[model samples]
Target: MGQLDGLKTVVTGAGGGIGAAIAVAYAEAGAAVTVVDINGAAAEAVAETCRGHGAAADAIQADCGDLAAIDAMLEQAASAMGGIDVIVNNAGVTRHAFILDLTEADWDRMFRVNAKGVFFCMQGAAKRMKAQGSGRIINIASVAGRGYQSSSNAAYAGTKGAVLAMTYLAAHQLGRFNINVNAICPGVTYTEIVSNLLRDRAAERGVTIEQMKQEAEKSIPIRRGNDPEDVAAMAVFLASPGARNITGQGFNVDGGLINS
Candidate 1:
């Protein structure tokens, strides 16, 4: 039997990148999944892929940045899957700008999705999971959350930092109800988001993307960039019985980029 047989799962931003990978992995593990994304067509495409794996999958078009949309999506997801067991808050966005160049809009948009969206999603999912008395909440944070890092602006990092904070607080409050809340911080994962960032960083550094990548690889102990599957594997473990004892923790999936 698959590790997560019969579990109900909700994954936000499942249209592409790390979110899509998580949805597919959850399905392969035998969980029914709700793929939520602001892009209706992309969400449907991912759902179809999940169905191909023999897991019940539904696509919900919703903006994770909107509370009303999130609530609606969760309600529909629970109804479609029977009950909610796992929630992966994997939707995020980033902007490249210096402190002086960062606009008010930049900061507002970053927080709206990365921090505010996460908090509401966590709150909504926690309520359902608490009622059920068992659930797993896995958030997709970033290595930038730990502290200042290159290639990202101050505002972007601040939002992830907020996510890390929320993960711990939610874990503490939900643990008594047998709900496990944790955050996975990824380092240099080659997602669409990273691709966009790389373009900007490459121009700034006057180097090719490959040169920038090779330079980054040297700093990482594993000497490799992350694949979407790498992050997906961790999500699978968190949803499995193996991670039952783990909660309120931020696990880095960055190839030892950050020792702490």
Candidate 2:
């Protein structure tokens, strides 16, 4: 039997990158999944891949930054899947900019999705989970939240720091309901977003993409950047029966980038 057989899962920002990887992994492990993203076509494409894995999957296009959208999305996902067993709060936004260059819009956008979006998703999921008597909520944070030196920007880091704090607080409050809350902080994961950022940086520096990637890996203690799958593996494990007892913590999938 698959590890997550019969589990009902909702993954946000699942159109691409780490979120897509996690959604596919859950489907492969036998969970019925709802793929949520702001990009409708991209969400549907990933949902198609999940269906190809022989698992039930639905795609919903909604912006995580909007509360009304979040409510509707959760309602739709729950109705389609019968009930929500897991919620992966993976929707977030960021841009590479110097602290001085960051604008009010940048901070607002990042907080809208990264901090507020994640919290309400957890709150919404926890409400259902409390009634169900069990659930798993996984937030996708970043090493930037732990004060990583080379974080993309101060505002982005602030948002992730909010996520980490919420994860811990939610875990404590939801534990009695048998709902597990955790956060995964990834460091230098090679996703489409990272690739795009690297592409822009490469153009600015007049270097090959491969060289930029290698340079990016240099700061990692293991000298390796994560594939989206690395984060997916952790998501699967956390949602599986194996992680039922694990909660109230942030697990860094950073290849030893930060000691704490």
Candidate 3:
């Protein structure tokens, strides 16, 4: 049997990038997955892929930044999947602006989806998990959260730091309920977010996007940026029985980019 046989998982932002990879990976492990994204079409596409892999999958479109939407999403997802055994709070956004250039709106938008969204999603999932007596929560944070030198802006970093901090607090409070909460700090992954950031940076430096990517690889000790699959693998492990004792921690999937 697969490691996640009979598991029910809900992954926000699963329409693409690392979130999509995680949802597919969970389905491949024999779990039913509810793919949540702001884009209905994208979510449906990912759900189809999961179903193609012979797993039960459903698509739901909801803005994680909206508490009401989050509440509805959880209710629908739980009903669709029977119950939630795992929740991956992978929905996040970043606006590239230095502190000096950053506007209040940018900061607010970043926190709305990145920080506050994570908090509400965790709360909704924890309620169900607590009653079930077991669950896994994986928040997608970034290496920027640790205050490392990154291409992202200060606001982005701040939001991630909040996510990591929330993960720790949630884990501490939920461990007694057999809930495992952890954060994944990915570094320069090849997602659309990074792609856009690289394009902008490349233009600023008068370099090709490919050249910019190569330069980024030099900073990572592994000499390579991460792939979505890299983060997904860790998420799968955290949802498995192997991670029963692991909680209240943040795992870096950054190929040693952030040494600390």
Candidate 4:
């Protein structure tokens, strides 16, 4: 039997990137999945992929940054899937910018979707799982939160750091209810977000995108950037029975970049 057999999972920001990978991974592991994204068509496409993988899947388009939308998204998912067994909070955004380049608007946007959205989603899912007596919550953070030197921007890092802090607190508070809360810190994953950042950075430095990518990979001790599946694998594991005793921690999926 699959590790997550018969489980019902919801993946936010699942239209693409690390979120899409985690959603597909959960589906492959025999879980019913709800794909949540701000983009309706993109959500449907990923949900279709999950269904093609032989799992029951649905799509919901809702802005994670909106409180009402967050509540409604969870309601719709629970209504359709019967219950939520696990939730992967991956709704995040960032851009390529230095510290001085960051503005109030940047902090507001990142915090809304990355920090606030994650916290409320965790709270909403925990309330449901508390009654059900068991659930897993995985927050997608970034190595930037751990003080990665090459972070795209300070505001983005702040948001992720807030997620990690919440993850720790949620785990302790929800443990009695049999709910697990943890965070995944990804580094240089080969996703569209990183691609766009790289493209822009390359232009700024007058380097080819490939050259920029190579330089990034070289900085990692493992000498390669991560695939979205790398993060997905950790999400699946965290939700599996093997992680029943684990909670209140941040797992770094970076390539030996942040060895703490």
Candidate number of the best lDDT: 4
Q: How far is candidate 4 from the true structure (C-alpha RMSD, Å)?
A: 0.6
**CA lDDT scores, all candidates in order:** 0.92, 0.94, 0.93, 0.95
For each of the candidates, give the backbone clash count: 0, 0, 0, 0
Candidate 3, residue 147: Cα displacement in angstroms equals 1.0
Candidate 4 local lDDT, 14-78, one digit each (tens): 99999999999999999999999999999999999999999999999999999999999999999
Residue 10 lDDT, candidate 3, scale 0-100? 97
lDDT of 2 by residue, 145-213 (tens): 999987878999999999999999999999999999999999999887788778888888899999999
lDDT of 3 by residue, 136-198 (tens): 999999888998787489889989999999999999999999999999999889999989999
Q: Once model 3 is optimally superposed onto the true structure by TM-score, how far is the C-alpha of residue 74 displaced, in angstroms?
A: 0.1
The lDDT, on a scale of 0 to 1, for candidate 1 is 0.92
Q: Write down the TM-score of every candidate.
A: 0.98, 0.98, 0.98, 0.99
Candidate 1 residues 136-237, lDDT tens each? 999999999987367488889889889999999999989999999999999989989888878888999999988888888898899998999999999999
Residue pairs clashing in model 2 are none
Lowest summed lDDT window (length 10), candidate 2: 192-201
1 against 3, candidate with superior lDDT: 3
Report the backbone clash tally of model 4.
Answer: 0
